[model samples]
Structures are given as C-alpha cells and as structure tokens.
Target: MKPFSGTSLTDHALTTGEVLLTYWKVKAEYQWDAGLAMSTYLNGLKQGKLLGIHCPQCRRTLIPPRVFCELCFRPLDQWVELANIGKINTYSVSYVNWDATRRQTPEVPAVIEIDGASPGMGILHLMGEVGDTLEAITRRLKVGTPVQAVWKPDSEREGAITDIRYFRPIG
Candidate 1:
C-alpha cells in the first residue's frame, strides 16, 4: 500500500490567488402537463368563470382545485362553478417588477376569497384598475373589499390565468 502524498489546499491560498474558478450560464427549456384538475380550472378561466373542487367529507370547497382533500385525505371529484366576484383576503403593494426592476406604478397582488368557495379559501391574484397613486389605492381597497374579475375579450382568452386580466374593486 502506498501512502497518499499531495499538497493540501488551504483557505488562505484559495481566497488569495491560488485557485482558478470558471462560471457558465446555461439555457434550459421544458414543457409540462397541467393534469386533470388544473386543466379544468384553467379552461374554466378561459370561459370567464372560476372553478373549484368540493370535498364531500369535509364539506369544504377549494379554489385552485386539487384532486384530493388535504384534511380528509380523500380523492376529490366534485367540481363547483364559483362566482367571479370575491373579497380581498390580504394583499401587497410592490413597486418592483418580477425581474427586480423599479417601476413607476406599483403592483398590488392579493389573495381573493372567491364567493362560492369555502370561507378563507382564496387564490393569489393581482389587483388592477384600482388607482394610480399608493395613497389612493390603499384608501379605496381594504382587506374585505369586494372585487370582480376583469376578463379579456372572449376572442383573446387562451385558457390561462391571464384570461382574467385582473380583479378590480366592485364599485
């Protein structure tokens, strides 16, 4: 057996100038299936409607429909058509874009509790047509303020969440 003999790298050596490093940016692309539950939900949006799933055991309706109940651990199949109107459960005002760029108009994202779904069951969405200034939007919109979906023209819907352009305060 030959004993190993090599120069051990030290932290100071690596930190100073003893080590060489390389960096690369790789581009990747992919596609995925939305499955039965999500596909139906998205299709419902394209038709200017909100859809949810019902759990018979717990008697609770869930938005962003799931194939199973989290509480009962039961497979869910019953589908319920929900109303486009809902109340804002919570929200956030963002001045930065998704790419971390600053923007003049702030984006308001909120969790809206759909009318037909169980209480406290909500979906995360953006609020639009509210107001331009921070003070105006904050003054007009509240946690429980009612809002309705603003759908794009029927001809433009593409079976995606964006089909509902955004939700705005209902009067």
Candidate 2:
C-alpha cells in the first residue's frame, strides 16, 4: 500500500496536470428485511420496551433477539421482557462523523450489557448526557457504570434501534 501523504484532498494534484475530473452527484435508496427474530425485537423497540429470546438449555437470554442458540444448538424458547437499565461493558469515542467528516464534539459509543441478559451480551449504542469534553466524559463513562435506555416518544418512533436514541447515566 502507498504511504499516506497526510494532505487534504485539495492539496493533492492529479498525476496529469490540467486534467479536470467530472464528479457525479448520485442519489440512491436501499432496503433490507430483518426476518422473524430481529423483526420482533424492533417491534419491541417501537413499543418502548426491550425483548430477548431465552435458550432453555443454557438459560441465556439474548438481546437483539436470536432465533437460535449457537451454543446450545437448539431453538430459543419464549420472548422475555428485559430491564431497561444496564451497565457499560465497553466503549469508544469518535471525533469524526460516520462519513469521516470531523466534528466539533466527539461521539461516545458504548456496548451496554442489559440487566437481565447473559453476561457480556450487550448492544452497541451511543452514550448520552455526558458533557462535551473528552476527558470529563471518559472519566464518567467507566466500564460497569450504570445506565438506562432513553426512549424516543412513541409518536416519534419508527420501529428501529434508533427508537431509543441513546443510553444515559442512571441517576
């Protein structure tokens, strides 16, 4: 791989000087169907709740609801309502946006293991209510820090994971 020059796009010139490249403005839309297990899980989010599938054999309650247990090699049994509160298992802070653009405020993303789910079984979500400075937020977002889901109003929900905007520190 070629070593990066660490220069901005506008600073780098094309190999052939005076050659103008035409850029295309494109727009597209895409869709994906999350069958059975995921569908039910998203529905629960729409209703301002959390749902998990229980594996009778291992008794593991899985979040984001799995249809089968990879460990037990059997179908997951009934759906169980899980506690909205949980603890931060792990996390990361991003200074850039999803498209790679830099932002003034960093985004703190964390994997919170739901209260009633099996150990280390958690969902990746943004950490909210943490103040702007990286140091301050990082200090507060320690592993095992208690948190709770902050749900969007039902009227604003679209049956997606975004239904719960982010998890905030539990008072």
Candidate 3:
C-alpha cells in the first residue's frame, strides 16, 4: 500500500484510499445466427463439402461465403461448390499453442487457395500429417504445394469450421 506510486494518478490520491476497486462475475448466454451466407457454408462443411458465393459481375468465387460481393457491391445469390483440394498459398510453423503454451509439436497453419475458386480465394486452415519435426515439415511443404482437406468423421461433424480437421499434403 505504498501509495501505488507508479500509477498515473497522484500518489496522495491513492494513499488516502480515495480509489475504489471491485470485481464481479456475471454470466450471460446468447444465440448467434451465422446469417444466410455463412449458415450455408458451414452446413456444407458438415456434409463434407466446401461452398462459396459467386459474384457474376466480378466473377470471383469467394469462400467463407459473403452475402454480397465486396467488389461489385451486388447481392450474391449464386452459390458454387468448391473442391476440398487446394494449393498452399503460404504457411507458418508455430511453436506456441493457442493458449500461449509451449508445444512440443509445432502447429502448421496455412492459407490455401482452393481449386475451382477464383485466384487468391482461399481459406485459413491448419496443416497436419506433414511431418513430425519443424525442419522436416518446412523441407517437405512449400508455397503452391497441393493439399486436401481432412475432415472429421461424419458422425463427429458439428457444422463448425472444425468439421474439417485440417489440410494435408496430397500424394
């Protein structure tokens, strides 16, 4: 209680016990709608398929389907099916897990440009079955390397992004 000297406020202000602190735990629950575009896209994943929206004007097929074309500013009504196979656009090897914990086996995340979609149209997914070590994975995988989605078993799919467990290099 040495007046919390380093704080931005004047030392005397805190030393006098003028500041009040409190903590509260609140619980709230809510439902989220994925909207028309995303709902369809996620459902397709549950069925072991990839879905996208096509902009007739711009002629770009977009994954993680949007309701409207960003470039053309028009409603996207036409839905197109995309191939699970794609080429790795770029990738990174992570030594840290999502929770900031050190991982013995590094995670490989990559942007993959799906086949049959417009150029540069891709999805973010993890790479698996590449290799056991960082060096081996880096040496074996590269930009433009062909890959395919590895989906969860049909019974395990829950209509979520994780429906497809990860992408792996195709032989």
Best by TM-score: 1
Q: Mind giving the per-residue lDDT tens digits that candidate 1 earns over 1-171?
A: 999999888898888877875779889888989999999999998888899999999999999899999899999999999998999999888999879999898889999999999999999999998887889889989999999999999999999999988999996
The window of 10 residues in a row where model 1 has the poorest summed lDDT is: 14-23
Q: State the lDDT of candidate 3 residue by residue for 109-142, as single tens digits.
A: 9999999899999899999999979889999899
Runs of candidate 2 exceeding 4 Å displacement: 1-29
The Cα error of candidate 2 at residue 111, in Å, is 0.2
Report the CA-based lDDT of candidate 2 relative to the real structure.
0.89
**Tens-digit lDDT string for candidate 2 (32-118):** 889899999998999998998899888888987988999989877599999999999998888998798998988899999999999
lDDT of each: 0.93, 0.89, 0.91
Query: In model 1, which residue pairs have backbone atoms overlapping below 3 Å?
Result: none
Model 3 regions lying over 4 Å from their true place: 1-30
| Candidate 3 TM-score, C-alpha based | 0.82
What lDDT does candidate 3 reach at residue 88? 94
TM-score against native, each model: 0.85, 0.84, 0.82
Q: Cα deviation of 101 in candidate 2 (Å)?
A: 1.7
In candidate 1 the C-alpha lDDT for residue 118 amounts to 98
Clashes of 3: 0
